[model samples]
Target: MAFFAALHARMTGRKVGQDRFGNTYYESRKMMPVYNRYRRFVVTANGQDPTKVPAEWHCWLHHLTDAPLPEDKRLPWQKEHVPNLTGTRYAYRPKGHLAMGGQRQASGSDYEAWTP
Candidate 1:
């Protein structure tokens, strides 16, 4: 399925810059009659998860910017994008999180009960 998508993209779409994750971006060479605008899309290097796309590329994919990253350029202060870790082993676990196998510490003197 991805193979055909890639082929179609290559045949009718212009290549945009690829992100660090290897996801390739593209824009239709010609406008579609249905939308009356060039269609934009991304081929994920691995999974179909959209979070894999970086913020800079996200803008281009959504047509937020007329210029793609290849032409627009990223700022130096920008950090590399990381996919969301939810549902994975690397997901954040607070001190008392059940997955962390730790119980919540008892409230101490600093704790105050709410009064009506």
Candidate 2:
């Protein structure tokens, strides 16, 4: 958090809750005239990586719900949140991708070009 942002959060923002990603959420101590509600914000733990926010926290961040959906009451079928991995070493690369050694095992169904 920037010096001014940290000061602002401390001066007027009331701490709400924190999500699993270590991001902390807050609302203004008083209602704002524009929205007729207290302002809300989040201090992300991973710098500017918004993808680190889970679905439930995303809801609260966007004012989609009065509060974040319960974390423990998750349905059995629900999967845990995973941040976007694009541009990182953990990102998916096809078997033949140049970064993956540019080699892929040839199968019987593989396409072949004409020799002509």
Candidate 3:
């Protein structure tokens, strides 16, 4: 993968600007051969979930950043990237989750519909 990346970059004469969360970005004074051609590919442990990537990486991927984020300059408002794993076991378990206990608390009252 790295070899192909290097080849493409070299052939295109793109300058590698930054890398974060295993993704790399490149730019060239010349336009890319393909439209919407992103210079970076995010590498993930399990793959999928763009959310798994950090905020900095997301910015680069979306062309929001002209330059990569610096380690010391991360903004206070930026939250750490967390993947949404809904329906999966790794998803966050709330205190009152049904999986933890067989108990089902009453919301107000159980209503039964009447039919003719």
In model 1, the worst 10-residue window by lDDT is 66-75
Predicted candidate 2 versus true structure: per-residue lDDT over 19-109, tens digit per residue: 8778888899889888898788877776767888898989888889998888878998999999999999999999899999999888899
Question: Which candidate number would show the highest lDDT if scored against the true structure?
Answer: 2
- Candidate 3 runs further than 4 Å off: 1-21, 25-40, 45-49, 75-79, 108-111
Two-way TM-score contest, 1 vs 3, winner: 1
**Clash count of each predicted structure:** 0, 0, 0
For residue 101, give model 2's deviation from the true position in Å.
Answer: 5.6
lDDT of 1 by residue, 53-83 (tens): 8887888878898876662466798776789
CA RMSD, predictions in order? 4.5, 4.1, 4.6
Q: Estimate each model's TM-score.
A: 0.73, 0.73, 0.52
Residue runs of model 2 more than 4 Å from their true location after superposition: 1-4, 101-116
| Candidate 3, pairs of clashing residues | none
- lDDT of each candidate versus the true structure: 0.83, 0.85, 0.61
